[model samples]
Target: MKKSRILLSTALIMVLSASSVYAHPGRTDSNGGHTCRTNCTERWGLEYGEYHYHNGGSSSSNSSSTSKSSNSSSSVKKSGQSAKEIATQKAKKAQQEKEAAVKKAKQIKQAEKDGYADGLKDGYNGISNIGISKYQGAYNKGYKEGFAKGKLKLTNEKNKAYRAGYSAAQNGKSSVVPSIYQTNKALSDSYLQGFERFVIDVEKQKYYQMGYNDSFNMEKYIKPDFDNANHIRWYKEGFDAGKKKQAA
Candidate 1:
């Protein structure tokens, strides 16, 4: 009975050693796995060319699952980075737009100020409101108002000059502008205009009276030595009227 037990134990050891050799027949790969080559279906119950892991190594399916999980995590991380980049770009763009708006506002304000100043000066100088075409918006409005004011002021000054010249001429003074108006071309021209009108009126009256007296005395009609055509025309008309009245 003792010999039979020892023999049984030896047989058990041989069986275990043969099973260990058969289970790991070929060399393992980096993943502790290799393809089945010899006795694939009979020894290991695996198909030919099938890959399997050994010694607690992970299976290809498990590696695939882990790889998929890792890729998913990497993809999530990349997605988060992309989102952050987009937000940063949007913030930078908003700041740029705000700066541009402020710059535009300053330019507009400066333009408005320059336009008003130019308009005021041009209006006061009596220059034409050409700023209407040269400038826009508030400038044109200011130019028109200034032009009206300047024209009114010029008109008042001309009226005063005309009155002074008319009084001088009626008093038999020389047709000359006063010293005060000589410095101003507009006023000087207006004064000369008034003085000439009064002188012409007096000359015209004298010619009419002379023509009337000659017609009453039945003298021959003769043209006067007047340089003015209007004066000669007035004399002829008066002579004709006097002849008509005498005949009536």
Candidate 2:
């Protein structure tokens, strides 16, 4: 009873009694219509707000809850996307490195193949070119070129013979292999046919056969003329001279 009286006294002090009302923006005329003409929804919302404030009932905070949930969902999705992107980038980088390594390996293999000296020389003519002759002279300058080359080789062979003899001496050898050096193309071709004919004749000889098997490849070119009839004339003469000296 004492608490009730105290609450009543507090309400009586706070609540306004009947007094002269001020004529303001939202005031009504004698007819009770608002001067400012506030909207019905707006007035109803203000009345509802006043009722909530005074009653002190529990209020739902759904808007705040929905905003928080939306934010959390967005954050989760962003984090998941970041993880996937990072993984994808790593995979792509790894693939690039693998491809690069494969390319480097292929390049290395190709380089190794290119390193062979024999393969490097395939583009040029080889030792087999020794068989060619300056026989044809259909072109005007051809014969002159061949003649000039022959003359030059004849001159060079003198010097070559000295060198060959020296080199042969180092080997403690009595003979030279392919003893003539044909420095020029024409030099080789000058005695080409005569050399061929001499080789054919020597191969036919029984004594020459017992000495050396092949004839096309002679021991060396000799200055004393060679042909089919005189294949071993030089050799037999040399043998006879040696025998005479030994008997002496």
The candidate maximizing lDDT is: 1
Instruction: State, as a TM-score between 0 and 1, how close model 1 is to the true structure.
Output: 0.47
Query: Which residue runs of candidate 1 sit more than 4 Å off their true CA positions?
Result: 1-126, 132-135, 219-221, 225-228, 244-248
Q: Show the lowest summed lDDT stretch of 10 residues, model 2.
A: 48-57
lDDT (CA) per prediction: 0.71, 0.41
Encode model 1's per-residue lDDT on 35-56: one tens digit a residue.
Answer: 6778877877667666655543
Look at candidate 2 and give me any clashing residue pairs: none
- For model 2, what is the C-alpha lDDT against the true structure? 0.41
